[model samples]
Target chain A: MVDGIVITGAGIVSAIGVGKDETLRSLLARRSGLPGGKVGLSDLQMKTILGIPGEETVARSSLLGILAVKEALQEAGISYTGTAVLVSGTTVGGMDITEEHYLEMLGGEHPELFRFHTCGSSTDRIAAYFGGFGSLTTTSTACSSAANSIIFGANLIRSGRFDVVVAGGSECLTRYHTAGFDSLMILDKEPCRPFDASRAGLNLGEGAGFIVLESSAHASSRGARVLGRLDGWGNACDAFHQTASSPDGEGAFLAMTKALEMAGLRPEDIDYINAHGTGTVNNDESESKAMTRLFGGCVPPVSSTKSFTGHTTSASGGIEAVICLLAMEYGFIPANLGWKEPSEGCIKPESEGRSKVFLQHVLCNSFAFGGNDSSLLISNARDYE
Target chain B: MNRKVYIRAAAQISVQEPLCEDWMLDPKQLSGPFLHCIDPDYRQFFSPMQARRMGLMFKRAMVTSRKVLEASGVECPDAIITGTALGCIENTERFLDPLCRGGEETLSPTAFMQSTHNTVGSMVAIALGCHGYNCTYSQDGVSFESTLLDAVLQLECEGAGNVLAGAHDEITDNVARLMEATEPGGYPFSEGSVAMLLSAGESLPDALCEVSDVRILSRREAVEEAVAGYSAEYVMRNDVTFSLFGRCGSASGLAVYAAAEMIAAGRYSSVLVVNESGSNAGLVFLKKV
Candidate 1:
């Protein structure tokens, strides 16, 4: 197993909470961050309780990314040296502002907001906000973006390209996708209950999650605290449907199998599985099938934390990784929040609130549109030592 | 240094004619601020039904990927990676227009589904039935370079055989106007797709050029500082043999084509392709072995 790359620090801002501590507090308390009622959008008629804080009147994707990066760097206790490469992932990017000024360009108003419309604009903005960096880029693969960012960051370190890299993604709830998903009939009218018999669809949320990844040699030389080891990661394409997973979950199966092969571990070694339970009818069934196919006899305790944060899409992978580290640090498994019954032949998730388990190895899954599927295995640093 | 990566074959579809031959020899000069692709017979790649649903950017990606794979003589790649700056912006705008004016109910799932940044990559994979490692980068000027870095890592460290990597970007009328207003010095926006089939140099005996190194800097000024220490005197001897597109927004993959052309012609044993934006630059070095 490749063991040189480790996560030194992580920061998350979701509907559940702002910082890691607050998010953990809410997770331990079994709190649901989904809005209780319909929250009005600025221009569109749709009303979904997107995880944005009510006080964030000026909530833009780039601003949220900057804020999340600040928290991560602060927790890592590292000053801005402009040495680390920044790899950000996002889907909405600056659409929150771009949508506001779309007509202004046609009217010859030439507003400043149009500059942030590109996918890379958010990453560049974050870099500018944080002075500068050795390099900067963005990975945008729908929902699995940040997960791939972590994978790419680890590969960069392993390839001897750089010693330190900051990798994550930020996405904001935009009317563009909210309306789009509604057209696809995937947004649940009420709060989503993932992996349940009554599972309807997902409730889209917005936030950012970033982790400071450094080589073990680099971290130890600097006396940095080690959070967790990024043991392995895998990505695969379904090639079945554009927005739907295969009935048997071929993509998810290959991704999980590849990740296990990379980490040189069997299915029995995994202590927990953070299922990509999008609460959609197709995703839950397919993911459940994939898990069963891989872990026949001993299926690990699996759950979807999307129940708490309303499926942050691109940021889901990053947020879930941080949650895994918190679980390992505090010695507890996060509750699945909402689940009662399970589909036939599928293992039930840890639906009961706050299961106490000494976790060692955790698997986080993030599946996105166009059948883009990814899995990450983050192990406790102590286990490796 | 780790194992070197090679560019087996590369192809592009730009404002000029879509051919892997000497199209760049005497390129058609742009007459207008908006430079649209010269467009090939896309019907040759996709069926009528499929073509109707796909966007122009998606079509460009499909055609370029096919040409690249044919040139490389590889039918199925181990992995597919892509990068795009303005991914399906036309479709994005199409989906956003009615939603902004006519509310959320008046939307179709087709435009919305095709609007994702990764759609181009995923579509290519789906068509090829490739279920291997798939990823897409969208970092504007460095988007294509990011994919190249991933391809290199796959070949050198991750134990992958052949990888198909490429970039696609299309500027909508609205985005062109925005660029004009925001960055006046920016070139008139253009749209195209560039694809390259990459393999490990040790395994591919028929490779065209070896990719020695790829460097990405956070600022344009750092380009000089990074290259100052390099032994690039060979490059300095070559005059302005190629005319740059003149401040094109970010046709990053075009650099690979230029570097490969120089290596193939035996003009220089090594060529460096550098793409610079205001606050960023992506440098790729190619050597003929």
Candidate 2:
């Protein structure tokens, strides 16, 4: 088992499901959560569980965050310890709610909504909903926001700053981002095919995913069951384009390389890769190039669950991370759905789901706009021991 | 882990004179409920083509970063980290106003592309072609504090020799009015940017000041308890710059800048910077090098 920082629990809420059990079933069944071409979660049913009054308008990001965080805390058996920190990643923030009332806000009405307009508001709302946290920080690095939050939380624990940190991100679809991505001509109206030759673009989704991380000393003292170990993480800037990745995938290559180096693992050791395949032609091709550059023909079973979950934007990193952990804990490989035919020079992903094989190491990638690319290396317990 | 972090250089574009420390000599008294940065001629640093597509917030972040790098002579920092609450607000409004006023018709992608919170920091990396660790924090008052905390860890523990860290936020008319009407009696809603080049103390031959510890806590935390263990010369409970610099999400950078200015001028050997947003509070410790 990993002898250091370990993941005690993880929680997720997406179109696929509200918790890990539901998500696992959907993944193995190859169910597409993109119900009828749109990526929307039913808020009425989710809100009933939130306990907030129906009249009060809570940001969708915060609502999803609370659901995920509550499940994570419950699984981790963590009580209300004020010293536990919360590092949240959310770029949508309250924009999901505020965008509807934008003009009213401009007119100085619905000013209450203004408080949740910033990117940090959702994190604050979640922390407030769950009593309080010792400290809170929010990362807003586009889609990688939540991924970077987990990295920051890991750094906090490694620095001997805190015993535990709740790290992940939550994002909800908004007309703001939908129209923004649409105007950029990157969104595909049809179902997205991540690595196929005809891969067009991504369908945006909304959800939240959170994981409870604790130091080895703390977990052992509390007799916590370690789900997985956060072996390594790396964040790098492409510096190539504001929104486009380099043709060589230099940033993605560097991020993956750094993570592998940190984890002290060779490329061949990784059992699977959760690709940042947003189905955009540029992204799939570039990420393949990065994988080729790093893995050099021996790339592992890589899959992009975005085809199933519909590119959750900021939440994809955390959601896919929990997905990887689930695959490792169980013995299943999530199929890279929507792949028809792979283009030349592009590595062919595992087209079908496989189970009953023990996974040792897994890598998940989340690349964001502005070329903020990040990669995480997760390892199953008992391997190192 | 105990390696001391040092501030090599500090630069700001605020209500005070841009590209200079005129605020220390003759501090500008904010005269309105909203204040804007007295921008310098960006043409000196940015070509017209480079300046054309960027919004004001992007320009301010770039100019301040250029200043920080120029002062420290560090062409490419090991990491570029920043904090911004309302990222690219001007662009956000530019993209939103037309669409919200009408329908989803004729929405431009330029503003939308530059509207992400990480745009400011990532643009710096693109300009310098420095592909290193890059991040953006978007909390409220503690945005800058969060960046500083990351920078400290980078320098001390992560083997990053140097880092460019800062914060930038701009208040638009609608947002300013919203803040004014909602949170009355608060500092004048303002716009500003501050960048600091930081390195470990032992690695740098000379530093402007030293940053030792940064602690973030809930807003419910008492100032005394937050600073109970640390001994500092200037223990700022609430940051001392809002009245002068006005209130911005990244205003805490102004506090750190002000603290560094004081340390440089031999006014204080050590200083504490505290910033409390609505939800959480951040405390930073700075000492004279």
- Candidate number with greatest TM-score: 2
Candidate 2 wrong stretches, greater than 4 Å: A1-3, A35-41, B203-205, B237-239
TM-score of 2: 0.97
Per-candidate local distance difference test = 0.79, 0.86
Please give, for residues A121-156, the per-residue lDDT of candidate 2 as tens digits.
788889988888888889999999889999888888
TM-score of chain A of each: 0.92, 0.97
- Candidate 1 chain A: worst-modelled 10 consecutive residues by lDDT: A38-47
Candidate 1 Cα deviation (angstroms), residue A39: 12
Residue A187 displacement in candidate 1 (angstroms): 0.5
lDDT of 2 by residue, B155-238 (tens): 755679889998999988888887776577766789999999998856454788988788888746565677767778887655
Alpha-carbon error at B114 in model 2, in Å?
Answer: 0.8
The candidate 2 chain B region of ten consecutive residues with least summed lDDT is: B235-244
- Model 1 misplaced regions, further than 4 Å: A1-3, A36-59, B203-205, B233-250
lDDT of 1 by residue, B1-289 (tens): 3456888888777776685656657766655667777788888878999998777877888888888799888888988999887788888888988877766666878889989999999999998899989999988777888889888888877888789998888877777777767776434567777888998855455777888888778866678777665665244211121133323433767667666766777777887766665357877778886
Clashes of each: 0, 2
